[model samples]
Every structure is written in structure tokens, then in C-alpha cells.
Target: MAVHTLSRRQIFGYGTAGAAALMLGTGAWSTDSAFAAPVLTGNPFSLGVASGDPLPDGVVLWTRLAPDPFAEDGKGGMPATPVRVQYEVAEDERFRHVVRRGSVIATPELAHSVHPEIHGLRPDRVYFYRFRAAGHLSPTGRTRTTPAAGSDPRELTFAFASCQAWQDGYYTAYEHMAAEDLDLVVHLGDYLYEYGVKTNKRGVTTDPKFHTETVGLARYRLQYGLYKAEAPLQQAHANFPWIMTFDDHEVENNWADEISENNESPETFMLRRAAGFQALYEHAPLRRTQLPKGPDVQMYRRLSYGRLADFTMLDTRQYRDDQPCGDGASANCAERLDPDRTLLGARQRDWVLKGFSRSPARWQILGNQAPMGQTDQDPGADTLVWLDPWDGYVAERNRLLAEAGTRGVRNLVVVTGDRHQNYAWDLKRDYADPGSPTVGSEFVGTSVTSGGDGADMTPQGEQFLAANPHMRFFNSQRGYVRVRVDRDRWTSDFRVLPYVTRPGAPVSTRASVVVEDGVPGVQV
Candidate 1:
């Protein structure tokens, strides 16, 4: 492929009416004045542009025609009719070297959102893209395709973050994340909170429109609009390609497979779940394969960065068995020992294990929602553990850890979210045995803004570290984790922000740890 240059100011005469006229194959606009479409008035790209699910030769570009994102009808301020939107991909930020150009239809049925999958591009290269519609040019977004399959890549730099509650505090962490020199961003889960906000600890006023918990499609769409409308969050999405998954809060709190936290009827809860899944699909830069089918969406998928890393993203909430021992922190009981209990359903477990057995990448990274390490809340004679995490599904955890050892995976790293604090642990084959083999390492990232202005440490944090011998480091703060992976070593920096209740919080490294290629533990 040869590089070509065009004027940055070059504007094509392509418009929605022109495209519609051409589609009719009769030049309808040129012949009939009465059939002319009305002119659009405002900027429709209020929610900004994003790209995700990047392959070696392709990437998905996303944008919504939301002139008014907070519209009560959840139509994104788009008319009832479908509209044509044009997009372009270029090798230069100035868009002077255009590589690919195409158009997609945005319909009201999907809230005028469009996800255009662009392909036929060179591998392991950075590209710039933008959307054009209604004579308005959207903010240019930068995306990069992964290296060719089975090709050896020297390095992979990425960040993983989660749990950004819009009303909790300012999105200062995302502001810093947007400035990082990273290839991709992996959002483990909790992209949006479903709970209503009346008042926050910061004394910030809540939007009345989102003052109620999101229940159906319209409310979920409104919540997404409210979050995506944030400048810092929008900047983060525009700066880099993101790989995202969902947790319970995206639909409701602590919702497992077919059971609701509030014990709502299955039929009623399924309707809410379906709406939440649909809204998530419509707002994010996901591919067609992830489209919602009723209450379920295919989320667990694999992404390869050449021979350097393989990211196996998991969906823990969708297929998980209900929390054993009646949920929350509790003492070990017989029900918790059920071998049939599962976190990842049988199919997903088989898929992940198979990937582990056959993966050729140097680093086998599990992008998961919950922490895999056993977190003992109380360490005395009466030990108490949180059942929502791996502690709840011990049998499955042991099986997966044993499988990793049996398969002889070179470097198994589990990057997780959902926990509001940062944790670095040495994953053991058996949590009950201190002498068990350390099969892998886990990095649990802190929240973006979920837990207001967190401190360096808390009493619970001290108890947690004192109780779990496998846990190496712990920090109660608001931020994300920056990771750099290479053939020889993997380094993670626990990036933290001082205060999220106020704006302009400076981000700093709270802790740094590195694991060598053959090492299964972290060196602080």
C-alpha cells in the first residue's frame, strides 16, 4: 500500500439528501423540488466519536446523531426517518492521506447510532477517523489495528479502568488517561451506574432527568447519554480505541444469571436486562456480533496483539450462579462447597480453557470483572469472605488455576475491575494452602470515580492485607492501572488521583510492580 495525500480542507459535496437521491437511482432531488429534505440545524455529534474491537486489518467506528443527548424520547434528537452518515479513515491526523471512505445509515430504531466496521488496512499501524453528516465534521479520532496474527511484536502498552459513577465525582482520572501514550484501553466493567443520584458526597447537584434508577430502554439510554456527555470521558474515548465489557451495575446491582438482587420476577427482570443490553450496544463501539439477542449479548471474546499478548475478556455477571452463603461477607458453609457452582458458565469456561491450552501468545491476559484472588474480610477463627468474587466459587477458581499450571502457560496475568481499590496479588492454585504453587499474577485496578475521594489506606484495607497472605499491595484511591507488556517482563503502575470531588486533580503513581517472564509473583 502506498501513502497518498489530499488537502485537509477538502470537502465533498456528499450529503444525506444526495445519497438518498442516488439510492433511488432516479436523481430524485434533482428532479423533484417537493421531495427535497429539510436542512439540519444543530451539531449532531454531541456524544463524540469512538472506536473499538480492533482486528489486524480492521476496526469499528462509532458515533450517534445526538443533537440533544438528553432528549426525553430517547431518540437522540434524530428525526423518525433514517439518515445517511459518511466516514473517512486516513493515515494522517490531518486527514490529508485518506485511506478509506464509506457511509452508513443511522436509524431511529437504534437511537441513530452507527457502527461502521472499516477494513482492508495495513496491520500494526495507527489511523485517524472522523464522521461527517449534516455539514458538520466530528472530532477526529485516532485508532490502531493490531499486529498481524502470529507475528512477534516487541511491546504492548495499555490501561485498564472501571467503575466510573458520573455523580460520584469529577472524571479527573479519565482526563489524565486521555493524555497517556497508550495503544488501547480495556474497561473491565461498570461503565455506567444504574442507580439514581439524589445528592452526592461532593455536594454536587444531580440531574433530575437521571434522578431515578434506570429500568427500561429509555432510562438506560438517558443514563448513557448523561455519562458520555462528560468532556473528560468523551476525550478518553476519542483519544484511543477501547475494549469494554459489562458488570452488574450496567443493568442492576448484583444481578446474577436469572436472578435479580431485589428478587423481581424473572419475566420483569429479563425485560430490564434486555433494555440495558440494547442500550449498551447502541452507545458503545461494539461490533455486529455483539448485538443483543433479547436479554443476552455475546461479550466474552478474544483479542490478540500479535505474539505479544492475548486478551480473553470474560462476562462474569451474565452467566454466574447466585452468590453462595446468601451473599455478602459470610463464614464458610456447606452450600459454598458445591462443586457445581460456577462464576463463568460451562461454555465460557470451556472456551477460555481451550484458549489457554492453544494460545501461542507470550502473555495470556484475562480481562475479567471480579477479583480472582481470595479476599478474606475477617481473618480470625470465624473467617468471613465476600461471596461476590472468586471466594464464592472456590471449585471453579481451583480448576482454572490448576488448568493454567497443567497447560504450562508462559505468563498468565489476570487484570480485573469492580473492586473500588487497587490490589496486586499472587494467584495460588489453592487459596487454603500457603504452600500451593503460584500459577499466575493478578492486578485489580481502582475505580475511576466510583468511591468519592478515597484515601491512601483504610481500616478495612489494613484488615484485608493482613488477612490475605497472597495479596502483595493494596491502595484505596481513585484511578486506573497502566500496564506495559514485553517478551521479557510486564510492569504495572497504580496510577492515582488525589481528589475526584474537585476538578484538576493531579495523577500520580501510587505503586509500581514488575513481573519477569518466568516469574509468577510481583516485585514491588
Candidate 2:
């Protein structure tokens, strides 16, 4: 807990709430610690404010001083110098009940971004935050802290979304999500893609920078500016605290560790990765401890929402062997059968398994970036599968799934991202046998706007359903998954949008699946 422990004296010193502070607080012009302002142009709060990584005591408030968003230089039109930004958090939407206030330095080293961690606040509380830099004030963001540690709460409601290609369509799904009554939003990855935008559906990327793939820090920043500056996405951020992670698109498409998809030199790919990691950290509402070190950013960590849920947000792309047999669907890929192949790597795999065994929460959520269930592209004797996800790393996936049953984990849910299609899977111990005992449930959410106005059902989805009997449901639609978790049941609604190429698309639930307590598989 840092400045969140606001004293009554500091609150009163600024004079009565909303009265004296309204006049003098407008420009705390005489503070000794305030950094010198340099006639900043436009509104520096163009990207909006966000909060994330909530704890029982605190949350991270994030913003960047980007007066000129989408500047070609990717510096958000800020100078090389750092600026002092002030933040205020209140229990109410109005600043009249302000509880915490502080200043943080937005440095050029981190692309003028600021993340001020507020701590020592009361647990299980809702707070509103905003940022002030130069003469500009940011929009207010709503955030909620987790229930007190070890306390079992009544229920938890949240949503998970992924894969919003800016060129594909608008973030209309996010607009609907922003209005939902939820506790937290988990971004499972693909926050931004790496490729250039050409013949775009939305027709907004006219900049020449959009003609080239993002390779350096500046280009990545420009890409983020294009996406994060969207009003709907920003509204989603301002609506609730987010648990964010990057999949392949944040760096490169289908990237495996330092191995680039186009087979670039390891050294070359590392530079690009470092730039991508830094850009993600700069723009996301993450803790300071999550800052990247070179090409390495440890994103696999556990967060507890009282004793109701344990969310283990994973990094599937950072520590995986390159996809075998050229990384696509193949009928007979001998390299994938190797037991050494892994998606979670060694340490992360072990860490997740251990946490599962000892976790006290009722539901153990693997906030994965890709599918964990086996999806056979072709049925019959010879197995055909995509060599990207856990299906490509069979032994490791089996080991993790088997241990969950062995450890007697209460409720296991693998909420996954990627593949712009919805799937509710009954995860079996062995996919080769149709009768293998069901061990858990894996809910694969479709994209926010990735596949560009997908249909309700497709030929590929039909083939998958026919090939995998354990697959309970499949819908090729564009939207997110709204989930509700309680002591006895967990429900997922496959919320879909008819179209996203334009804007103002209403969402509807295509299907719903329920996983009852003590039951491992799904019930449609």
C-alpha cells in the first residue's frame, strides 16, 4: 500500500471536500515536488485512463501523456523529457469524496506512461480514478478491488476477450462489454497485431506506417495508439479493472519464443520482442514488477478473488517450443509426438500444476491465450491437428490434465483465447479414446473482432464437431464470453454479434453452457 493510505489531515488541508479543493486543487500550482510544465498542446489524456491487477488493498492506475496520439514517431507527441502526472482516487464518481491523491513521474524511457500503485485502501471496495498532466484532465475510470484475502465471496462475474485485429473490424463487442455489469475483464491476448493494414474493412489506417509490420518500439507504439485510442476499447478499460496478457500478435504472429515465424535470426527477433514487450508494458495497466527485462517478461502469475476464484493468467507464447512440422494443420506430424514438446515450458508448467494442487479457491481458472483441448482437423485413423496449441504438445497437456484429477482440484476451468470461434469442450484425459473420463472444462472464447463478422456456423466448425465428440458446442461468431461463477455452478454465455465491419452491432447469446459443482464436464 502506497499513497492509498490518505490521512484526514491531507484531505482537510486542501479544505472541505469539493469546496476549497475545487478552487485551489484545479492547479496545485505551489507544490514543491511538482514537475515543471511545458506548454503541452492538445489533451494529453487522449488514450484515456485504466486500472488493473487489483488486490485486496490496491490497484494500478495507468495513463500516458499523449497529446498527439498516433504521431508517426510513436512518442504520442510528448517530448523526450519526463513529466509529473497527478492522480486522484475517490470512493464516489465525483471528486467530492476523494480518498487518495498522489503524483507519479511519466518518463520518456517508458514512453511517457505513468503507473501509480495505490495501496492500503479498504478491501472489496469500488474506486474511481483519473489523471491530470499539464493542464489536461483524464476521464474517470471505475475499478474494484478483490474481496479480502481468504474470504469466500458470494459470487463473481467477469468476461474474457481476445484477438481484435484493428483492420478486421470495429471493437463493437467492447462497446457492449463496457456496459455489462462485471467485476473484471481478462484480455487473453492479441491486443494488437504486428502486420501492416491494407484493404482494411474499417478503412481508417491511411497512415503509411500502417503499410509495414511493426518491428521497433516506435511502430509498436503507433499500432497501440491506433487500437487503445478507440473509444469503445477505452470505455471497456474505464469500466473495470483488467487482467491483461499478450499472445503472439503482441509481438509477431504465431511467434514461438525468440523464434520468428518468418525464420528471422534469433538476435533479430529478440530485439523486436523486447520492443514489443516494452510497448505492451507502457500501454497496459500492469504493475511495475511486470516490467520487461530485455526480451523476457514474466507474465504467468496467480490472482485470488477471495476464496471464490483463483485466476492464473498464463503466457503461452513466451516459453514454448516452436510448432512442429511447419506450424499448421497436418495429417501426420511426427515431430509433435515427441514428449519433450511443450506449450507451457517446464517451470510454468510445474508452477501451474503445483498451484492447482494447493489452491484454496473454488474455481481454478487457467487464463490461457490459446486452446488446450484437442481439436482434430480430420477424423478417422490418422490424427490431423494444428501444431500451435496444447494439441501440439500432447504429453505435457496430458500430464497437467491428469494431475488435476489426481490432486482433487474442486473446479477447473480453462478459459482460452485465439481461434475466432467459440468452443465448450469436455477435456478428457486422453483424446484418442472417446470414452476417456472427463477431467475438466475448457471454454474457448471467440475474438472481440478478429475474424470480421463471422457466421453462426461454418463448414470448419461442423467438421470439428463431427471429428471431436467431446466438443459440446462450436459457434463461428465474433464476440466475447460472459461468465458467472458461484459456489455450485459456473455458467458461460457465448455472446455473439451479427456484424462488426461497421459499428453499433447488438450482441446476443448464441449458446450457454453450465458446469455444475463436483461435475467436471459441461452441460449444454
Candidate 3:
């Protein structure tokens, strides 16, 4: 069994309260060799730090310290070491006049991951922070708390992205996002893949040729450790406080609460599923409330951006009925159209509906795991895929949209991940009718590195778009969205980075979609 043990020398060197290092006895594992380990080797900042769910007066700071990363057991071969981590806030780039300072201890039970909800600061303020353990110092990170409640800020800029498979390509998208100078980032899902790959060389796209899977906690932790080893992804997490949600890939490709009825054993899969969920909580920087409830817990919740927007993040995978294998285009396959079956579940759906009904913000946005807008498969048949997202839950979708329409919630926008493509659509009553009326809006973002399949607009995708007017635009591209929200309008510039298979590739603007307040849909 792998063991986590701390030497007395390291304990003395690190001190009690996370101060600088003291002279220590030297051994095979030293700070110098640890930090200098190859990219794949375990490092202090191996998993990186991230902040998320930013509130007006506070934001959540997250970091996981792994002394011996590759250990099969979570122990990382180090005895339980507790290190105090101090955070600093500053208004200027130089941090000349520090605003807030405090410390939190990184404990081993939680894999040494720290989530300090730094509160009691100016709202909408920019700050800088870093961590120090022993004589070693972590990379300087940039983050800010939201403005105080009831303060009307002039403009808000943020980015949303998802679906990064480490073996697929480098995290070039993260490199661009870190330099975007945005206030926050919204991640729809698939933060890390529970799989591994074998490659010939470094600096190139690798493949898991065989679908290596994650079973126990050790496998999951190592998978996360591998992805965090990327410098660009680490920098992006260090750069901003993120708002994250989980989709299917966090566990498996399209796993629901139970197994797919015909695919696997529900009892066995649920136990594995629970392990995956716990591992995610152990590694990521999410709040206590976001923790898993049992073998499963819903992750759909709401976050607001002052009076500018209200974001409702949803979990579509955990609450839906089994998708049809070959139910075909018959009404049976359209089981999603049944009012009995649900997507958001009762409680989550109610929470979102009530939120939309009461929201006073100009824009009601949804941070969804799958596509909510209608798409075309054939004619007169606006059938949703039983295995895919909204397609698997049609009746529930209609009810949600119907509620929005009836409540007169103007400018309803949904930001989505999964499908590994970018899409802009006009949510309407019907897409197959050809005379459907626009109800709300949706801006679906493409994946970060999942086989940029649709990066180039496909003829089939284009033809589908033409047939379905509700879908204003679509692209199979690898990129993220830079959104700017003001009092009157919101502009999303689809920023595309060059192919990640190649290094230092130049980024270019693929397109831009803009939506105005009170406008139910978007235009070029």
C-alpha cells in the first residue's frame, strides 16, 4: 500500500504556521528536485489553484498540494503535512497597497486542497494572491471578489469554456483565456478526463489508442494530476476565479444517475460513480454546498452578475431517463417529449423556474451541460437524441421554455458545453414548423481540445442550419467565448486559437454574436 508520511525535518523546515523554510535534513526528495521534475512528474503546483462562484464581497480560492503526485494511493508518500497558506489582496498590479491578508491550512484528508472563501472585501475589486509553504513559494495568482451587493457596475467581461481532453492536444485555449483580462470564467463541464493515453513524443497530440478508464480514487487522482501538469491550464486557473459545472465526461461519456439499462449493471456503476464524484470534489476548488450528497447529488444552481445577468447552471446527465438505443424516429424515441420524464428533476427545475420568474436582471442566462435549443434530424420531425442532451428530455424542455415565455423573461440566454462545437441559436416555439416564433437565445461554446471535429463548418451542419432557421449559426471549431455585458447589450466574440497539434499557433477571431436587451434572439 502507498503511504503518506512527513519527516520531522520537513515538518521543522516548513514550520507550524506556513512561514518560510528552515534548514532541513537533505534526502532523496527535496524541494528543488520536486519542482524540477519533468512536466509529468509530481510538483507542488501540479494540480494548480482556481477560484470560482464569486460573490459580491467574496470569491472561492482553490489549490491542491500533492507532494508525491503519482502515488497509487491518495497519500502521495508523504506523512500528513499541514501547511498554512496566506492570501493577499491588492488593487494595483504591483500590489503596493495590500487590501486583505489571511491564511488557511492545507490539510491531507482533502488531498491538501484549500478552498478559502476570502470575504469582507470591496465588491468588484481586483486582487492578487500567492501561497507559501516552508521556504517554497507558489506561483503568484490573480483573482478578484465581486462588487458589493446593489452596486451597479458599468461593464462586466467574462469567458466560458469546457471539454479539454489532455491527450487530444495542448491547453492553448487556457493560455489565451488567462491573457483575456476578463473578470471571471464559466466552465460548463468536463474539467478533466478520467482516462489516460500513450504517446510517442511530447509537444504533440497524443491518443489513448485504447480507451484507458478510471476506476478507483488513485486512477482518478492521477488523471487529474496529469492534466494539471500543463503550464497553460495551470496559468488560466491562477489567472481568474471560475464558475464551474460538471457534465457526463467527468464520470463517463454519457452516464446518467444509473447505468444505461442495457449497457451496464446499475448497482455496480453507481458505486463507481460515487467514487468519481468524491474524487472530483477532492481535487477541484468547489464550495461545501457543492459537495456530493450520497452516491449522487444535483449540481444545478444559480449565480448572479449584479443586475447584468442571472446564470442557472444545470446537470442534465444525473436526472434523465435512459436514452433510446434504436427507438428510431418513432414517438417511442421521442420519449423526451413525455411530460412524465424530466431532465432538471423536480427540485432543480423548480429552483430554476422560480429564479427566472423572480430575476430582475436584464439577461437570464443558463449555464447548461447540454444543448437546450432545438436541432434538426430530418423534416417535420424535430426529434431529440435519446442519448444526447435536451433531445433525451423534450417535454421537460418545452415546459421550461413555456415557463420562460409565459413569465416574459426577456433575453433568456444559455451558455453550454459538450458536443465539442460552437453554436448560436434563436430559441423558438418550434424548429420543425418553419414558422416558429423566437422565444429566447442560446450561445453554445465549442470544446477546448476534443478533436476539433467541427472546427470547420461542415456542409451537413450548414445545411441543417439553413433548414432550421432557429439555429442562426453553427461551427465545429476548437475555441472559447469572450463575452462583454453592458447595460444595453452583450457581445460574445468567438475567439479561436490556431490548431493545438502545433505549438505557438496564432489565434484568430472566427466570428462574433451580439444580443441586445429585450431581444429574444441574436444576430451577426
lDDT of 1 by residue, 1-524 (tens): 11213211111123555334323211112223222222566689999999998899989889988888888778777787766677999999998999999777666667778888888999999999999887788999999999999899999999999999987888989999999999999999899999887776557776687788899898899889988999999899998899999988999988898788999877677778888887898899988778666677899999999989999999998888999877887785666668899999999999999998999989999998989988888757556788888888989999999998898798999999999999999999988787999999999999999989999999999998888888899999999999999999999999999899989999999999888998897778
Model 3 agreement with the true structure over 173-281: per-residue lDDT tens digits:
8888888889989999998776666641125544342235776656777677677768888888888988888887778877766754336555556656666776677
**Residue lDDT tens for model 2, 1-524:** 11323343332223444322222221222235556876887889899889999999989888878888789998999987757788999999988899998887676767788777888778889999998888888999999999999899989999999999999999999999999999999999999998888668785647787688899999999999988889999999999999999899999999998689988877677778888988998899988667666677889999999999999998898889989988988878888878898888899989998998888988999999889999987757767898999888888888888999898788889999999999998989988676789999999999988879899999989889888889999998899999999999999999999999999999999998999988999999
Give lDDT per model, in order: 0.86, 0.86, 0.70
Alpha carbon deviation, residue 146, candidate 2 (Å):
0.5
- Measured against the true structure, the TM-scores of the candidates, in listed sequence, are 0.92, 0.93, 0.85
Root-mean-square deviation per candidate? 8.9, 8.6, 8.1
Scanning candidate 3 in windows of ten residues, the lowest lDDT window is 20-29
Candidate 1 lDDT score relative to the true structure: 0.86
- Candidate 2 or 3, higher lDDT? 2
Model 2 TM? 0.93
**Poorly placed runs, candidate 1 (over 4 Å):** 1-38
Better of 1 and 3 by TM-score: 1
Cα-based lDDT at residue 292, candidate 3: 56
How do the candidates rank by lDDT, highest first?
2, 1, 3
| Top TM-score hit | 2
